[model samples]
Target chain A: MYEGVVQDLIDELGRFPGVGPKSAQRIAFHLLNSDPADINRLREVLGKVAEGVTFCEVCGTVAEQQRCRICRDERRDATLVCVVEEPKDVLAVERTGEFKGRYHVLGGALDPLSGIGPDQLRMRELLARIGTDEITEVILATDPNTEGEATATYLVRMLRDFPGLTVTRLASGLPMGGDLEFADELTLGRALSGRRAL
Target chain B: MYEGVVQDLIDELGRFPGVGPKSAQRIAFHLLNSDPADINRLREVLGKVAEGVTFCEVCGTVAEQQRCRICRDERRDATLVCVVEEPKDVLAVERTGEFKGRYHVLGGALDPLSGIGPDQLRMRELLARIGTDEITEVILATDPNTEGEATATYLVRMLRDFPGLTVTRLASGLPMGGDLEFADELTLGRALSGRRAL
Candidate 1:
């Protein structure tokens, strides 16, 4: 039962992924009471991103230029490419500070039930990128989910015939934080099945 | 580390009141992937509000013109004014559909420690509004918290001598939803002290 514009604002804020009605109301009113200058700054940035940002032509990560910094930097290891489902996945892997390689975003995972197939992805572009002599190994670093696994499997089948190309799926096991007793049977089985010679 | 613009967008999203690092990252990336049309709409509305919305000159609620809709409506009971601390409080009281009267927004609660005093509030404007011929009663409906109580007490004292003005404070009691056993001692004491003979 709020005023029209206020209700509109609350409804819009609630459409965001995790923001519920109560939170949306709180945020909307907070914005209503806040100084216009601060709110304008946020609006400006959002507008700029929508207008200026685009997916990297080389890797599909968000960028203002043709290629993302990771793809453009000459110092990055061109021999190693980490394949992932979405641009956000690229950030998740980068946060660990362990991988110093380039990335190739697949736009989305393969979900056959939803009618998504290999042709919908940037498979041809990835194949062309790999055709260059600089790349030696491709790391399948997609999420450890069913769709991600299916996408990785599809990529493996498509790229297997390329001579001298070594394809490897990232390892899955008990999480660093996990309790063995609480682990599900399938996960425990996978942990056992994928055991390494320690 | 991400490309500079992605990092900038993440930082900007994080500036919202309750959003944390992971949430900010997710929203930033969602915006990155979302249809540019939707992002443009949000930006347009935000810009519109920033440029056009203003405080009602009469009651201090958010408005697009000189007065808020409630105040501008001739049918509303101008004789009774429900005084509240913030614009959001006005919306909450309105949602009940119980108050037939209009509202007087105090901008914020009284907090001497925070350097907010009676002089900083809209008390003078409230007095001016009440002194007019049509007004009959003033209802103090500030929140039950310490700051709200202080503000209500200040209003009561200030309006004690107004001729023909019926000054009344909203009753303090156990909320309709609240468990009596879970209520704090002070609130329980108030509930017991204010008990009516049924």
Candidate 2:
């Protein structure tokens, strides 16, 4: 019952993850009800990101110029580079206020079934950064899934012979707020397997 | 390390509904790692939606101009208006290809606790449309929840005095594919309370 632009918006919104037909329509209506100025701001920022944003040549992170903010930060620990399967992992880690080191964004985890391999990722660039920079430690921060484990294993083997390079993986355990009884078998199993000395 | 623009994109992605901290970072990284042109396209569309869209004056559905296309169509049955709470409801009805009438979007349902009242809705415009137009029947297609019920009741009472106006509400009960046993008590009660003879 709407104009072409409204329909176009609904179509576009439906493409987002978890936004079904009904939800898409709701979002479209929300946009329609909102002030044009506010909507335009979102559009403008998105447009700018679309036109001007790009990947950092060094570590495969998004950037407007040549390097990403974290990579360029002078205060970050250059010697400790955290490797993650995706860009979102970096943000999650950062939000915790725990990490003050640089990052290397691997486009994706090692999905053998999906045919993704070492060549598909920016592995060569990661090796280059490790070789040239004064990086003393490489932290594997990929997800706890099979693909993540495979990727981590591959990286560890690849960097085994490199001098002065210490490879470490993020610890796996039960979540802080989760109960021991309700924990899934796999997670509880992993927590048990990766147990540490007191 | 990498660049700052990628980090900015991740931060923005985190703000979307259902996008967790990790997922947001992943999407941002994916966009950064992908071709610049693709990322730019998404941003451009997002920005354009924010800037270029608005609600239709007559129907409150999303539109590029004064009225939605359905409201503007001369051949549509202005006499049979389907009233819904949101623009998304319009789409759901449209998908069925059954109704041949126009629509009146109420912006939202009645929620007293939330402080929403008749003043907050486009009730004036709706009444005006009914008064001026040759509307004969109205279908109240709001959801079955309390807010939707209240909105429908409010409309029914508001339009009761209009001459030759047939006010009908959409039936509520079990979904077509749903198993009766699995249905919650409330839905089962509605199905029983609204039962009809064959």
Candidate 3:
């Protein structure tokens, strides 16, 4: 429908996770209209990413070098490690400004149907860090989905024998600023069963 | 929240039309995880687009050479011209397989709020082409919105002085696959006004 390279560009843009054909066309046109410098900047960044993003050797999060910023920061409590599903989850926890601990990114949750088991994720690396770093507590910060829950459960079993290491899961309840009526029964049940006194 | 170049890649991806921050991050991660060949292919296409695209000398649609495929084809009706607002609209009309005429892309409509007017568009070039092309009919195929209507109305006035030229507009009625009950009053009124004698 368009010139050769223009159509090609649109097709390529459409391959992105959430971009539809219309959005691909829109983005292609946007790139066409953008400054050459801007386009080149994006291209340069992509080229660098293609070269590969380094992951931290300790906790398996994205890093510029062998270790991530959090792993390298001496101020953060290394004894407390937050276990999560992906590198992105590390940022989600960091955004809260509440956690003063380090992170252990598991690459992804255990989805046996998808063939992603303990061997596929960074679970071994996480366990090794806990054993060597004298980590006192492990907080399961995985998403509250089926796969996440399953991964957390498996990790609890794996960490049960680690002496003096406390394991905890994130609390689930009605979200702040959300209507109670809108909360699903499962969440409402969790909130009821996990009730705490002030 | 990410490494230097990785975060730069995410920021660049976010600049694409319709891609929000989360989608940008997802795309960035996808690119990071994708084979190097895929990233390079997309990059190569963007580079070609950044080099610049050629517009048809005759119809103002995207073209590899002096004229578009439709304008260059000898079989198309030389005496009929389809005036559209963008190159994408040419594809829309072509997809219907109903029209066999060349196109005149106005680039955009009379969007005065955005500082677009007759002079800003390809109006003068269109008039010049009509003077020399021996065109007998002009089909106004702009969009159905306010700006498209204004441009179509303006073109009608411009083409009126040419003798032997028939100016026509694409019909304004309910779309073929659309439900009449779901249509707005304006569209329903247009449908009533432009009812064909079947």
Candidate closest to the true structure, highest lDDT: 3
Clashes of 2: 20
Model 2 off-target regions past 4 Å?
A52-82, A91-103, A106-120, A129-157, A164-198, B1-23, B33-60, B63-78, B110-120, B172-193
In candidate 3, which residue ranges exceed 4 Å CA deviation? A179-182, B177-182
The stretch of ten residues in a row with the least summed lDDT in candidate 2 chain B is B1-10
With a 3 Å backbone cut-off (N, CA, C), the pairs that clash in candidate 1 are none
Ranking the candidates on TM-score from highest down gives: 3, 1, 2
Please compute DockQ, using alpha carbons, for every candidate against the native two-chain complex. 0.49, 0.36, 0.75
Regarding lDDT, does 1 or 2 come out ahead?
Answer: 1
Q: lDDT of each model, Cα atoms only?
A: 0.84, 0.79, 0.91
Better of 2 and 3 by lDDT: 3
Error of 2 at A87 (Å): 3.6
Ranking by DockQ: 3, 1, 2
TM-score of each: 0.92, 0.73, 0.93
What would the C-alpha RMSD of candidate 2 be, to one decimal place?
4.7
Tell me how many clashing residue pairs each candidate has.
Answer: 0, 20, 0
Q: What share of the true interface contacts does candidate 1 keep?
A: 0.41
Model 2 interface RMSD, one decimal: 4.2
- Which lDDT tens digits does candidate 3 get at residues A7-118? 8998888888888999998888788779988988888887887888899888888899898889899999988999999889999999999999999989899999999999
How much native contact recovery, as a fraction, does model 2 achieve? Answer: 0.49
